[model samples]
Target: MQPRSPNTAVKFAHQVKHWRLAEDIRAFCAAARQSGAATDWTQWAENYAAAIDSLAAPLGMPPDPPAGQHDLRDYFRGDTYAHPWPFDKDGQWILADDGVDG
Candidate 1:
């Protein structure tokens, strides 16, 4: 087989790093849910956002990117099946409807 191009190698490395980062974020979210760590959904979202930002820092990513760049908050609000968190009128933590049925 022909040797891989330098650009191809770089892209592969980036892809691997991205995949690992996604897994780490998934695990963090899972553990956070299991732990009942934070009672406030927004606070939990902010904390998770910070955690992900720090995780991406070593990869040369900005914690909060410039305007027009993808904001980490969008990740939490994305179309993915991951349930959104919200507090009810009684202030009890709850999983907000994501508009997608199980």
Candidate 2:
């Protein structure tokens, strides 16, 4: 099999990063609303994580942690909340980096 191109690899990495961030944000939001050790910071962290994913995805890549992980914490280690891109973004339909968004 042929080795994946640099562009392809980058794209995959980006996607993974993006997804991870989203997961973190979602978790943070949940924790903030709930009462417990979790606090507002938790929510911010999650949002930042999600933002990273969003930014990376546009470059043709997967979200961090490769999606379906236990939680965003395992996926990313950051200080700022990463916002996810709107569903209408081109990256949303990126099936592959074949020059087509889908």
Candidate 3:
């Protein structure tokens, strides 16, 4: 089988990080709402996207697939493990929150 391109690997890593953050934000928003805190979807989406971009930028990755391309879901659907590793399993790709992997 052909090896995945560097761009494709970078995109895959970015997608993984992006979705992880999005899920965290969604959970936080839900908890905040339950506790009567204000929640703004518009601002949240913007901030979330920006945060994802910031996290991805240092890796020299591109932004999420443009709207002109296939849908985001379509772009991600495949054997993602085929992508190359940006960092080794023991290497620090992301800092841990609780002083473990960080």
Best by lDDT: 3
> Candidate 2's C-alpha lDDT?
0.55
* TM-score ranking of the models: 3, 1, 2
User: Could you list the CA RMSD of all candidates, in the order they appear?
Assistant: 20.7, 19.3, 16.5
Clashing pairs in 1: none
- For each candidate, how many residue pairs have backbone atoms clashing (under 3 Å)? 0, 30, 0
Q: Write the per-residue lDDT of candidate 3 for residues 1-102, one digit (tens) a residue.
A: 432455566766767878677767767766777778755774576477567753545554454332321233366656545644333345435333434553
Q: Which stretches of candidate 3 lie over 4 Å from their true place?
A: 1-3, 41-102
Candidate 1 residue-wise lDDT, 1-102, digit = tens: 532445555655665666676666666776776787644673565456556443455554223212221233464546433544454445455566634597
Quality of model 3 by C-alpha lDDT: 0.56
Q: TM-score, each model? A: 0.36, 0.35, 0.38
lDDT of 2 by residue, 34-55 (tens): 7565676776676577567655
The candidate scoring highest on TM-score is 3
Ranking by lDDT: 3, 2, 1
Candidate scoring better on lDDT of 2 and 3: 3
Candidate 3, residue 48: Cα displacement in angstroms equals: 4.6
